[model samples]
Target: MKSILFSTTLIAFLALIPAGEAAAQLIPQPWVSVGSRNDETTFSIGARALNLGVEFGLGTEDSTGVDALAFVNLPLIDQVSPYVGLGLYSEDQGVAVSGGVQINPTDNLILGAGYHSIRGVNGQVGFRF
Candidate 1:
């Protein structure tokens, strides 16, 4: 199941590079996106990776966590860009590094998959601007 998700994400990511490149030519700066962060079902406030950008969650939550991520945008096709990020998350369990890919299947939708340090796999979908 995890492999399937990762494979699908990779395919979608590659499919968008061409579109992204075309769009980049029209737009000077790269696109920016903001959305809710979640592990799977429960929504939480925190960052997944450092360079990926910042995310804040609304609600009551108490926990200290930090993650460092690096992302690169790839122009797959016109008006579409796919990006992949890698980073590490540290918490009570110590530290774990994770790698994931995000594909913008549409203008506002992002699909992604990541593996946590504790050997857990995560798949998520979020809206992006």
Candidate 2:
């Protein structure tokens, strides 16, 4: 478990290096995301497809549960970008490391699915601009 977390963190850090540089040159945008992890409410805020972001859980079994996330987007087609992200979450079971992908259907709407160590499935919809 430690190794998995360490490796996931390492990969996320490595990916962020280029993302940070790219973000510096692009216009920053704000996005709001809401989802569920293990049937619990989840939320996130950040710029779409760039840099640092944060996510949190509401009504979570674990008190004060939260996750920090980093995202990078790749242009796939018009009005769509495929995104990859890493997340770390606090839970009653333990700290969790996770990664997932997001699909942007429109500039304002995003659909995502991912996995976490503590939570089995993650799904969310985000409004980005």
Candidate 3:
């Protein structure tokens, strides 16, 4: 199941990229996202500097966690960029392996899905400035 989702995401990303162009910088922007994980609603606030970012999340479990992530973005024809990231979270959440992908349909809108080793899967939506 995970393989299928990964493969499909890869295919979609490849299909969107142009023949020749540099991948855009995806992590340097200040962004915020809201989503749900394992039936628990989550909210994240973060700022990305260069290829790395730091984020804080509030979960319905009544715990607040912090994560540091590294991102790689592939530009898929203009502003349609797809990015993948891996991160580590700390605090009451301890250390949970986390990773995700986000696709930018427009310059300001982002849609994504992610998985957390302890928190389960999530669906995300956000805006980038």
Each model's TM-score? 0.44, 0.51, 0.57
Candidate 1 lDDT over residue span 1-129, tens digit each:
999999999678657557754444333222222222344232222232212443222211222334445555543543332333333333444444545566667765656665444334555566543
What is the Å distance of residue 30 in model 3 from its true position? 3.1
1-129, model 2: which lDDT tens digit per residue?
999999999788667657755554255544545555667765544454344555554424654445666655554543434343444444455565667776657655767776655554657666654
lDDT for 77 (candidate 3): 47
Model with the higher TM-score, candidate 1 or 2: 2
Clashes of 2: 0
lDDT of candidate 2 vs native?
0.56
TM-score of 3: 0.57
Q: Going through the candidates in order, what is the number of backbone clashes in each?
A: 16, 0, 0
Q: lDDT rank, highest first?
A: 3, 2, 1
Q: How many angstroms is residue 69 displaced in model 1 relative to the true structure, after the best TM-score fit?
A: 1.3
RMSD of each: 11.7, 7.9, 9.6
